[model samples]
Target: MSWHSDDGSGTTADRTVEVWPDDDRLAEELGDALRDAELAERVAAAGRAALAAHRREAAERDDLALELFLLTLVHDSELAGGPVGVRDRSGSTSRTLVFEGDGVGVEVELQDGQVEGQLVPAQAGRVTVRRPDGDVAVVDTDEVGWFHLDARPHGPVRLVCESTRGTCVTEWLSW
Candidate 1:
């Protein structure tokens, strides 16, 4: 049988089962399982909160040492045939950005909705690409410090390279 609460809460079942006629072992087990589930939920919530806080703190600190400096736009296929100061985006051309920091040089190429890049001074390490919407792609560099990503992101994006020398983060760029 089921009964509905007058306060519009919900319906409750008043059926009785004899699964544990000897004692309340079934109820105890259920209680333990529920407690474990609740604890897990709380831990997950705490972790989410901590991550949000960290993102906020990172957003506020713009002068981090690991933050890489924007050197210059070394090359742009769009401007290959045009004047140096001319701006054009009507053609299907890739863009290349060069960033230098901590004696390391990174070349990023944005082409056909894919990101491919290389690092100078050949070193083995990991490269993390982060988008403005918090989406991330992590890839390990080869022994020659080269990495590629099949996935592309919209809006502004940044890169953080971790190598034996140190960690360097690139400034956000939109292409």
Candidate 2:
């Protein structure tokens, strides 16, 4: 038994294959192969089911994200359009970004190779630093809603705040 098939580069390739010989073991081997194929199909179905469930969960999270406060960029001190923080002692061209909102306000200070922030209407919470690559860090706020990220923002970054009051996701900003 022999055959010819494409080698997957738009080129045809010669192939050689052998079929089972006619013998008492042939039937048993065929039955085993069939059973193995069935098992493979079952496993594939399970994988599909798991993928669907994961997608559904992601959709649910997106829906809930709608209720979250999307922190908008209201002020950027470097542009001289807003106020900058006075606590920047290391002064590595420190910049302040204020995201003002009706319910919760946020101020982010970038200085001395650190990212510091404070939430308005101070409350305890968790802030997740998210970057285009992936999650950078998740830092918990103090009782006064002050938090700092250990990871430095290299590129565009966003913050997801989950506090006692509510959840909010910030707009992506280039750091």
Candidate 3:
């Protein structure tokens, strides 16, 4: 199910709740499985991944924003369908990617081996930039929702944001 929320910013945001299939057997099996601590941990991780995938799909379709956790894909980029970032004498390139998830949005710019950006609606939060290998950097956004990270390594990357506005994860993008 889905509901609306206001974070004292006077803006209403939509949130989605967990939903389970209408199958007693499956529920019973999951209940039994949870009894095993190790198994339960694995199951939880798998479930989170699955939920992320679902959110990514919904975000790609321009679905409503989720208050608890929002996973979104890149919505637009002037540099879309372009070649690798070109570094000039300054040894940095500039490309802005915009991602939208309901009431929240993140705009990231990569340049000079650093990732800098701002969050729409401007709230304090944390930004984690991760690659398949692991998280490359985690930084806190100022009260105005601006964050910066240096020493970025190029590869496939995804961004996760957490704040009073809630959590949001962006789809994997080449960096």
Report the C-alpha lDDT of model 2 over 1-175, residue by residue, as the tens digit.
8778987899987778767677767888867876797787997899999999999999999989676877787878877745544554554467788886558878888877688999887888888889888898999999989998767777888988887767887788887
Residues 75-150, candidate 1: write the lDDT tens digits.
5554566653333385655666777764777887777777788876788888888886775789999998899988
lDDT of 2 at 105: 72
* Candidate 3 Cα deviation (angstroms), residue 171: 0.4
Provide the TM-score for each candidate, comma-separated. 0.52, 0.64, 0.53
Q: lDDT per residue, candidate 3, 16-74, as tens digits?
A: 99666678877887888889899989989999999999999988666435344555756
lDDT of 1: 0.73
Q: Rate the local accuracy (lDDT) of all candidates.
A: 0.73, 0.81, 0.81
Error of 3 at 82 (Å): 9.5
Candidate 2 Cα errors over 4 Å, as ranges? 1-55, 81-92
TM-score of 2: 0.64
Clashing pairs in 1: none
Task: Record all residue pairs in model 3 with backbone atoms less than 3 Å apart, i.e. clashing.
Answer: none
Model 2 residue pairs with clashes? none
